[model samples]
Target: MEEKCLNIESKVVHGHSMFDPLTGAITTPIYQSATFRHPGLYETTGYDYSRLQNPTREELEKTIASLENGKHGFAFSSGMAAITTLIKLFNPGEHIILSDDLYGGTYRICEEIYKRYGLEFEYVDTSSIDNLKAAIKSNTKGAFIETPTNPMMKVTDIREASKICKESGVLLIIDNTFLTPYFQRPLELGADVVVHSATKYLGGHNDTLCGLAVVNNDELAEEIKLIHKSEGAVVSPFDCYLIIRGIKTLAVRLERHEENAKLVAEFLKNHESVDKIYYTGDTDNPYYDVMKKQSSGFGAMISFTVKKVETVEKVLKSVKLITFAESLGGVESLITYPVVQTHGAIPEEIRNAIGVTDKLLRLSVGIENVNDIISDLNQALI
Candidate 1:
């Protein structure tokens, strides 16, 4: 047998092995202590407190940074906690240009929390570089993008957007939750920072809640370190272990997820009840070329609208195999109504303007037998 798995898939499984240098175990053991004993008054073992760092969490962070092609990584108690810390990088007068069709929770933070603090934000169609260019103000400090944006599945050209941010001297931050590093590495495309909701794709099992941020440079890493430590929203050692375990099988899971999603999107396209589909795997999808250029695979998430709004409730109530749930990226399938579930926090006017209407439903295509997954949807649509 090989001493280590050498490919990216293998690396994900064994690269960050915190295998006891002492015991030669395969898995990294959780260092459950809140504080560590110092060697002496002036000496240390490199760890002082769990809030600042822990060996198990460090292993996960390092693994994710390597996967994302970044120099540093930080893990948080939840995805929102990670995003909140990234926002802290800006000051009261600084501004950030973001995707208009982002996760509703992100919009809430920008509008309700950060706006009150004088941190201004402009929401625009990031798919159009011209929109991003026009939205940048003198106070703009960063551009936050959600390529393959939630629900809408909009694919922004990361390389082109990165060029704009670099020319304007602004940071480029990408939310990589939908694609995960298994299919896309945003930092490699010139993004300064990449964030993931480990609760979704990264955790892959929907059994854990965690968030991660990876930074390209040492300076931003140190700055994030301060905010993460100060906020005390560090991910638990156990949860870090869970995420690490999830990543080990990410490659296989994603392959199955994408395969199933393509079949489902095809089925939806032919069904008369379906009005439109928002999956990037289809060559006719508006973002198909850009997605092909930036990612190894189109992600599993799919959104579609029905012919009539009344049919929405019928489909939701009729699905026998796929569960109606809030989260995604698990072995089991989940379907959600973004307007009422994930995007409800966003104002109705704004949501409608962005195409998040009551007739739309988002599917988190799971790694199930494609025929069965299709069969369940076929009955539900009728």
Candidate 2:
């Protein structure tokens, strides 16, 4: 239905539709049936069991694919499930290189799950192309990067990294959760595949757990699909519908999120209690130039270090409006201490090396009134 011609905002709001012909329902039905009925031995229409595929889920996948500018998209039960399926493409004893400041869950999955199976990984400061080049080995099969990386907000040069991977015969995979397709189109930046924790920004409301992986190549798309089916970490029809609803407002929500985040970062930068603020949006930030080159917006996430851990604790406890939580990219503002929360799984030595200190606070700014959010922070800091 000429989906490619539609803009991203329009696609988010009305990309795919599987409607009830009789009722003319605006929203897609759940299609909760376990399996579809076959009229004859040689059936024309493709409808199978819920495990293989669901009409509701298919619509959501297509919508996401269209939004991300990719050939295919696969939904999973959770972010980690989608990540595991992607990593499984590499055989045992193969190697993967990742950004040092990655999400703890992703680090755990690589170190604990993949390690037991003989897969190896090395964490490097991927913000520089030189660091990435130095870390590459003969066995390196993949490069998994989280630009504007978790807790630190460090931006990596995706285009340069993609070129390095291509030259080295390494697959470039990026976790586009922080910025989402609304702000950053990774495939357009030359990434082979892009993954998302739909439980975060893509879902927008923190209502359901889902993950998506969109691939630029058709073969890799099919491979991950096979791995997804074999592992059976598929998202439920109901959850897919919830995500579809959330995505309708993604563009608007992200716009507000970025605006709020910029205000918060500015507030922190001037605060006496703040030792440092790490936000890609800030012109003074080291990653700002690279971010401007790669992304349309600097995104909603911000990280900063207070004068001390005690100050961090007090600010978190004193906040009246923002919730102290682990997850980010929701409608409601969230503040988390990475050392004790998101990056807790990584060792202290490694965390410190990556600039995730005890006093560091990561804020996922929401689409709330800017003054109200700033006032809450000001009062908390005072």
Candidate 3:
């Protein structure tokens, strides 16, 4: 198939060159070295310090950029490192719009670390274009959006929001961690930048900590490169290799993840104990149509609420197959209480407004057998 016509599943396998040019190695080798020597005096081999670039890291970056349809890609030590680099791109006095239902760590860093530097953030429901438009201040430089948002599963129309951002001279930054490029390509939908906590789905097995940032334009790529280099937050060669290995199976894994999630969502929706369920796969969900229009799949993350806060504890303590823990998008199922886990850093008032209440529980439905997963949930709810 032509490169441009290749499907995402195909892209996942062949996005970057699959073999090493030097030795015909089928897998990209980890170029594990702190620095590379110049070919000769005043001549360069296109690599200097590992912090600036590495052969293994470059391959992963190029592959991610190809997968996202972006011009350039960068790798970071962690998701927060990528986010920190993004925040540094703006001046202290400028403002950025953020999703109210953002990840707790993102909120914590912005509130506790960046806010002290004179950077301002406005939390708004970006799912409603009108609310996003209203939140844009004169000094607003950009907007950070999370669709199928963390814990809440709120979906925002990236194309529509990007058009508004362009009109108002604001960059559109998307957290594409939940739905990897295999499912959604935010850059193709008009986002200027797409960031990911590759430690999640992109690292599929949950064995590595890596972050990625892809930009659609050269100027933004240059800007991020400076921050990535100067801040010394680049991903190590070995972690880059692991993330690359994870990317190879992403298509198949997500296919199973979504399939299992659909069955689980159906089970939860019918159960008497599940008072309210959040999953984009539900046709009646507020963002269902929008999600269908913008992406290929509903993703594996699901959040549901029980009738009482006490039931939440009962389910958490009772799960046998599903592990109650932090972090997600791995082969093993994880059930998290966002009120005390992922979204704990956000204040209570803000949390309640965004529906991260004590009665709510989030599930990272893994690529497990549907019946076994359902059985676990069935037993836990009792």
Q: Give the TM-score of candidate 3.
A: 0.98
Pairwise lDDT winner, candidates 1 and 2: 1
The per-residue C-alpha lDDT of model 2 at residue 120 equals 92
- lDDT (tens digit, per residue) of candidate 3 on 46-76: 9999999999999999999989988799999
Best by lDDT: 3
State residue 223's C-alpha deviation in candidate 2, in Å. Answer: 1.0
Model 2, range 71-133, lDDT digits (tens) per residue?
898999999998999999998888899998999999988987789999999998899899999
lDDT (CA) per prediction: 0.91, 0.89, 0.93
Tens digits of per-residue lDDT, candidate 1, 1-382, equal 3423355677677746546565787887888989999989989999999999998899999888888877899999999999999999999989899998999999998999989998989999999999998888889999889999988999899999999999898999999999998889999999999999999977899999999999978989999999999989999999998999889888999999999999999999989999999999998899999999999999899999999999899999999999998988888899999999999899999999999999999999999899999999999998
Model 1 C-alpha lDDT versus the unseen true structure: 0.91
Error of 1 at 72 (Å): 0.3
Q: Which stretches of candidate 3 lie over 4 Å from their true place?
A: none
Model 2 ranges with Cα > 4 A deviation? 18-24, 42-44
Model 1 residue 209 lDDT? Answer: 96
- The residue pairs found clashing in candidate 3 are none
